[model samples]
Target chain A: MTAPDPRLSINQATIKYAPLAEALHLTAGAGITSIGLWRDSVEAASLPEAARLLAGSGLRFSSLCRGGFFTVPEGPARRVAMDDNRRAIEETAQLAAAGAPGSAAVLVMVAGGIPQGSRDLVGARSMVEDALAELAPEAQAAGVRLALEPLHPMYASDRAVISTLGQALDLAAPFAPAVVGVVVDTFHVWWDPELTKQIARAGQEDRIASYQVCDWQTPLPADVLLARHYPGDGVIDFAAITADVQEAGYRGDIEVEIFNQEIWDTPPGTAIARTIEGFGSAVSPHLLQAGARR
Target chain B: MTAPDPRLSINQATIKYAPLAEALHLTAGAGITSIGLWRDSVEAASLPEAARLLAGSGLRFSSLCRGGFFTVPEGPARRVAMDDNRRAIEETAQLAAAGAPGSAAVLVMVAGGIPQGSRDLVGARSMVEDALAELAPEAQAAGVRLALEPLHPMYASDRAVISTLGQALDLAAPFAPAVVGVVVDTFHVWWDPELTKQIARAGQEDRIASYQVCDWQTPLPADVLLARHYPGDGVIDFAAITADVQEAGYRGDIEVEIFNQEIWDTPPGTAIARTIEGFGSAVSPHLLQAGARR
Candidate 1:
């Protein structure tokens, strides 16, 4: 088999059923050099233990799966959400420190949906800003970058209010790039008309903290959340988007973050093999040096 | 029953099963003064007969349901699509002439999805531009505004390539405002961060040809295409969006267009009643003159 692209990172969600040890082992066994960790599996293994395992695998920790969702109204619930995010920030720093050199101390942030029973989308978005104000310093202190992810507009009302790269950049503007940055997830943003320009802007602003890859095709599964696919499995033009990200000067690990149930049901090793193959064909060539087309 | 708002128009798709005559009768029977016609049902009834029936119902023609889907590449099929759109434009003119005074000559445009088997979204989008450029003059000659509708991003790949009001306005910029304008359907664009500014821009540019309303809720059904809800029944803030349209200098009819399976299954009269009740409570107060809250 062709060696995995050095830039390929297996976002753990692709193997949703894998336990932490198995996920890291399967990813590394497939010749992948990096992995992004989700909170639950990491917490199950405990921060210190997860870090130990990651270090043992000799794989870079590309990023922590998430840390936002603090769109609740100001109250005890909001406070609890903020505290959970603080712990996530700490976990991110610890894991990044334990990984092989070049791991990114980035925590993906999914701005929560409009607050329950509320029609105030603008209000809910402001709460994301408020949460960022409250957490930016905590993240900076922990030496972690809060990578704000702008989910697709389909999820704007029920999953996340942040729905565009331009909007994410606007929210990140007030903070230093190291403390607050944006994620360029192909699955979530491939539909944006402003993607090319916004990505260039993100590069100039130095706010692109994470670069994740996946594909989007429709007849989107009943549970739309699992609608993502392996890179070449859908119609997303990875060449263009990947070239855009590369042109933006993002020379970071590219995480393959699929969320389909069919993918999850696959054996973790087989899934990682598929991911490596898909990435090799769909994304890696775009990352190669001039005239080095795969 | 409270009178339907004078600005309100019943788009026939809300009662998807209704024949043209029944849709017109049900709308006028329920005290709604305006009705938007879908091309299929209009053609089914024969445009002349449908026009005669609409005249008898005493309902003003708000706009035509559609005249787009021209993203096909240059070929006989593409020519067919363009010809079909021309026919739709003619039908819009005839129906408007047959309706009561104050009817609008507008043809809604839905930019077709990416061409079959193609992953080039940008290319597909450029096809939309090419279509507008080709058809704008014809539309102008026909005295009908081709109102571009920006479907939500979820449908960007397979329904409409135009996914934001700003993009619609940009596409409409090359032609006269009267020839190429935009449709602001709340269900599709309510998630945009740039919505408020874009609406203001559309007003200044005089491109707000139509304003449609429907609520958006989560757990979208099996066929997400039919996920829209009545105004007050879901989480969309109609007051804010309706106010934005009003402030944008859009004094034209506001169409209530929904595509919910449940709504379609309801008896046409009952559904129109619910739409009226929802609009009365959710959108009317925002449309009244200063201090004329309903």
Candidate 2:
């Protein structure tokens, strides 16, 4: 068998139960070279300390957990959200400055959910677009790329209304290269019939900022917000998708982000180790094989 | 508020734990004029006895609970599965014979899951098509319309690989009028971005056999075979979709098909009553308003 791809990264959320320092050490020890940091963990550790820990662990930063909750209509709530996103960009820049040269990670964006009592999905999407336009210039000046993460349609109501890669790309289409792009999480998008087509479009436009992997389980709860499976444990055809991503010319970090009660309950070290192994066995085979053929 | 639509029907699978006869009785008692039946329950009671019960109740049979599992590869397995489907079609004909004249309920078709250990979704879909070709002539002769139910992508592995109304319509595209059509279940298809387009297409082709609704819960499970919510209980934009369906000229029965464990554990009578109430309050308003404006 061919050697596994070395660019594989583990998102801190995959081992969310662990402390940042512990998660960093565990991820690096698992042979993963990069890590995506969540804001909550960074806030808890303080950005400087989190940066110091990463520096000590010799882990590359893939992308920051999130920056955009841009769907709060035009009001104090919207202004407050924009202000917070700016802080997020600043924090991301700080992390980048503290890290090695050329190791800057994108600031992942989760365009906010529908405003309370709002049923207009189209309106909510427009709000996200407006927010992106407002924030793009600042993000560009900070030397940080904004990676819009398209959540699953199940989340369109209460989470990010930008629920498809195509939709995200459409919003990002007119933006400058440094201003906006997209983050593809397997858990959020594996079921889409247009997945391959959209990913190719993202690549053609040079809009792929990140790629994530997870699984969709069978017997999902009627409330989909609570349901998510670990990579390789659910029904997603990850191999097929990774092949498509590569074919689309998206050479980026493959980050694992699973939201599971079982993984959360486990110790951080054990979870990270298991995630790495699952990634190697289930995900790497396809990428490695594809690379060999090429 | 306007009066509830008398044409709406409730599929007994919506309250899966309810006994078949009781679900029918409760639906009728709630002023619902129609009901959909599951074949397994009918088989348990035997078709003659089930027909007798329905005839006694004076309720319109909206559709039979499915006939196609045509994806098992050729062999005794394939032959046996097709024979079973043929029997289901005959059972549907038997029910139609016992019901009111010109009241032939459609026989719903759930294209089978992937054959054991197989990963080719395209191949499985083709199997469904081939099976439909073989079964259509017999079903047509028996005066039964096969309503192909496009299950969600979550079921693509072990259930119906036909995961979208568009895909189902595409499969049924070449067939003669009313020989093959689609069952539009909101629970299975609410997440589709192209749902509105496909619904209009189904109406254009005059191929909508049935319409069903349920909610999608958050935190979806690893197994989605069992995950579903009651109407108005989750985040799907039901009012928008119902209006679209109405605009498309689909004057079919709106069947509620919630597959929730909570509803199942409740008494059948209570579940059916609550479903009727929810449907009236949550779905009827937009539809009634649309009708008035038209």
Candidate 3:
């Protein structure tokens, strides 16, 4: 049997109830060397305390949860969103510096959904483009990379208008790879017909900023945002997708980012155990082993 | 101001609870010359009775609701599904013969969801292709057209594996346009980034068997299938899509095929009136009028 992939990371969202310092300690005790952080969790724990805990524990922050909602249609609201994103960049830079050198502390960007009382998807997407032009320079100077996440089309109305990886890549095309890349979360993109080609394109462009894993289950909970399942619990072909990501040269942390209420209700240890187990069962076998494809 | 497009048709599903004979009288009474039928309602109303009513009511049977659930993995169940579809074709042909002589009595095909205990979307799609190949000859012989309908990606796992107009067009390519075509329902496809291009391709190929319209509303009802709103009630850009569909050369019935429970709860006359009003308000403006574009 192949060994557990050292690249495995547990996004804090997979066990949202676990306090950050406690989560860090628990993750380290459980022998996990990497983590993806959510801004609210970090702020709740206090950024300095979160930074110090990560620094002392040698944990890599795979990415910081979200910095884009640029669909405010300009004016004070848009400025506030841009300012909030700038602060997220500052936080990402600080965390990256605090972590072991060479770790990528990427800030995820969930391009906001359509503006209220509006149905103009094209216009909303353009807002994201304009915001990126304004924020890319700040991201580059701060040494923080922004990973534009293409949420599933179901969220097209309320979460993110960038609903396909190809579209995200097109938006990221005008910016440098170091400053603008994309997050490939399985839950949001597994059904995409263009997934394989776009993933390959992301690799070709060196813009695969983060690789997130979660399975998709049906009878999607009414609260769709929290409906993500742990890796092997749903129908996503993880081994196949993971193999493709590996072939695409994404040699980075594979973060499990589930948001299921049931999973959240579980004791943190049990939830973490289930996530690691599911990750091992669904993903570890696909990692390159002895130069032989599974 | 332009006259309401005479091509506008109301799918029986738009007023789901209305009795068949009453619905025909109501629709014809409202000056609608065409109506799409759902098989269950026909079967509930009895096929012979339905045929007799349409024969006397002077209402064109625009299309027949759904005859494909071909995603059952090969076995006895698959054979049963094919046989059921064959019966649906017979019914479609019978109803067509009973209506206006030139009405293209089309059967909408919703390729069923993933087979139980199966996560093989490709395999399911292949089953649909094979089923189509098996059934196309029968469809042509019966003088009934099979319209492959691509449901939204959210329904990919549970309702239909065919989730985009492009995939539906690809599937129909192997068969004659008269034997196999595609349904362009705005609710299922409005979110597709490639919608305009695919709609154009469908027109170029002469395979647009039906054009279905219903607005897409979010905070989707728990029963997602019933979440579709009447036109002008949600985020869809009806004028743009209707114009594109028209440009694509679809001069057939524009069917309002909603499935909302609230609408169903409304009185049949009230529901039909609302549907006509929404159709006129949302679609009538973009329609071609008397040899000139609106």
lDDT of each: 0.92, 0.78, 0.87
Per-residue lDDT tens digits for candidate 2, residues B68-161, read 8889898898999999989988988888776654355589898877666655556777888889889999988988889999887657667788
Q: Write the per-residue lDDT of candidate 1 for residues B91-167, one digit (tens) a residue.
A: 98899899899899999999989998999999999999998898888888888889999999999889999999999
Q: List, residue by residue over A88-132, the lDDT tens digit for candidate 3.
A: 999898887777654686999999888999978778889999999
Higher-DockQ candidate of 1 and 2? 1
How is the predicted docking of candidate 2 categorized under the CAPRI scheme? Answer: acceptable
Weakest lDDT window of 10 consecutive positions for candidate 3 chain B:
B1-10
lDDT ranking, best first: 1, 3, 2
Candidate 2 regions off by >4 Å? A1-4, A29-31, A101-104, A116-118, A217-231, A288-294, B1-4, B15-20, B101-104, B216-230, B288-294
Instruction: Estimate how well candidate 3 is docked, as a DockQ score.
Output: 0.58
Q: What's the number of clashes in each of the models?
A: 0, 25, 0
Assess candidate 1 and give its lDDT: 0.92
RMSD of 2: 3.5
Query: lDDT for model 2, on a 0 to 1 scale?
Result: 0.78
**Model 1, retained fraction of real contacts?**
0.78
